[model samples]
Target: MKTTSTDESSAGGVTPVAPDAATLESEKESMLRQPVAVWATALACVFAFMGIGLVDPILPAIAENLDAGPSQVSLLFTSYFAVTAVMMLVTGAVSSRVGGKRTLLTGLTLIVIFAALAGTSGSVGELVAFRAGWGLGNALFVATALAVIVAVASGGRAVAIILYEAALGLGMACGPLVGAVLGDLNWRGPFFGTAVLMLIALLVLVVKLPSTPVTGERTSFAAPLRALRHGGLFGVSFSALFYNFGFFTVLAYTPFLLDSGEYGIGLVFFGWGSALAVFSVFIAPVFQNRVGAANTTMLTLCGLVAVYVLLGVFHGTPWVVTVLVVVSGALLGVNNTMYTEMAMSVSDNPQPVASAAYNFVRWMGGVIAPFASTELAEKFDPSVPYFTAAAAAVVAVTVMLFTRSAVEVHGPHAV
Candidate 1:
């Protein structure tokens, strides 16, 4: 009887030996371990993401305090995402020229200044304008943070991605809770609180994070826009755009449908954010692995559509709406991960350019949804906006179906 060695066990092929348990354990450890700079940056990312939902618990309060209608208040999201979307194109260009560290500092400083200003605003218009400025800073910081983490982290790109996603999840989950606690005191409390926390993150980054020099060729301002010429990239971007329409509608408008106090809204969204975090960090990969990215995206979009429809049907029922809102987070979480993976893999353009292009297009949905949903509700009925959101989800599902082949061809092995 012939026996094979542990290193060479293949019968007629050259299949590589699988990593042993000790090697795998070492790799796991490496992935988990991070440098101080990376931790600081990640901490800043947490605060950055907190800004997304921090205003949620205070939306009603803001409206009541400033005598703004729902449509006017919703412009906060419109202006912020609009500026962020446009700035996405410039982030790569600026980072390439100024280096990542300066870009990050610049972004963080802008956020600190603007968030504090937003807290002091006497009118909704002022807050909206400040939020737009905050968006610019956020765009600059987020666009570069991932690349820096990937470059400096102990593990490879995969581990870096996991870390970034974890930060996003944690930040998103905690943002509402923080907002609720502070907004209970005053409508302006969440804004000032965000400013203080972001300042802390900024100081930590300044002290711990080393300056990252420009490493390669500078990217052009137009590079991201030009990347949309690729069929696969364009398809994914547009599909994500529609998906985000549904996403922000639920996020930005649902609070108006409920009579809940600031604390109640915060508690409900805390559950929503928690569900989002859990699914994004843990469940997304497993679902993607089992269903493939295209199918997974389609499934999640379908789920979103159903949730939106249910939300519309039961808008008057606070308990029902709250439950559906929390459930929708799971679907949104899966879709977010799948769409991000698709955007990253389905294009031949450099990762940064492609990411910028995708973000620019997709965020349009966020820019439009808040104002549009509020207008639709005011013009027709409250349920109309949810139905519109459901329609957008349908469009997203259709687009994903049509673009499956192109995406599959260019997608990563796992996808």
Candidate 2:
């Protein structure tokens, strides 16, 4: 006798057919078993994002080697992210005109050139300027990467986004390790290493990814800004700005608070990054499946606020602060995945346009936090930045609450 999977004898009639073990396993495995193109783009993405934290362990070395003040050296981040934020507006336009494959190659080429130039710099100003160029390259590549991944990857948007976030987390976790190891030998080594790795990613992409020149209507320069008019997209991006403030506070300011050597600080952030990867890939989805995306976002934001508060309360305690920093990564990973998914689904704009718009607003917090946290620490005290970050997180939570309906998810696994 053949048996069906569902029961139909209930008062309400037919019961919903739940997926069986085989079906469930297939879905789970799909996320892992992507095509060569998806893996290539993801691998390149890892190298691209590594540039963000690549200098974290070597900031002091750069300052000392170049005879520059902390403020000037900090401009490394300021310049990189500032250019990245502003150049986001141009990414969609460029990608639309040149197509995704060409655009990605161009961006990777620029990073290769600038990163190499940065390694050869004789002055802090030169390094900063080269970093700015690198940012321009990053802007093009990073903005287009998510759209490309979503378009090509199997399973669904949910699985694709998880892959992207995993790449982000892995890159972030590994960036500091690379920086610490190479920087311990010489500050220029990290820059050169990033350049070489990016070069390899570029070559692999050229071979593995097919040409995808756009045939659709070209995106305008103002498309990203215009895309922000959608309430859901705008609200999500706005909240992200505040949320990122808290995120960067820990990333930029915590090292100073640790007062550890390069290797020690590198290991701490590595742990943080590893936790971020694991949580984003494995745990965040479970939370989303259990509570839905909207609720999960709110819960994680609250968790972050609490973490920031604890960091402030224990600023003088290195081990506690170190642990909290790693803990924050889990929360950050969840939020990053959720926000990117929402940003893509929230608007009717093209994926690249939506990504460009969201990143534009999102990275402003990156630009502000490093300088703001450091300045606050100098002007007030060590604890003030964490308290301030907590306040910023509160603002994020409040914004999310108010904007909740626009981006709310109904089912377990809904993107």
- lDDT by residue for model 2 (144-216), tens: 8888898899875667888999999999999999989998999999999999999999999999998896877
Worst window of 10 by summed lDDT in candidate 1: 9-18
Candidate 1 at 10: error in angstroms? 27
Measured on C-alpha atoms, candidate 1 has an lDDT of: 0.84
Clashes of 2: 0
Candidate 2: stretches off by over 4 Å: 1-24, 409-415
The per-prediction CA RMSD against the true structure, in angstroms, equals 5.4, 5.5
lDDT (Cα, tens digit) per residue for candidate 1, span 1-415: 0112345433321222234556545545775789999889899999999999988888989999999999999999999999999999998899889998999999999999999999999999999999999999999998788778877897544456656776877787799899999999998998899999999999999999998788679999999989999988899999999999998998899988876988888888888888887787667766765566788889989889999999999998999999999999888877777777778667667667887899999999999999999999999999999999999999999988988987766563231
lDDT of each: 0.84, 0.85
How accurate locally is residue 264 in candidate 1, as Cα lDDT from 0 to 100?
A: 89
Error of 1 at 236 (Å): 1.2
TM-score of 2: 0.93
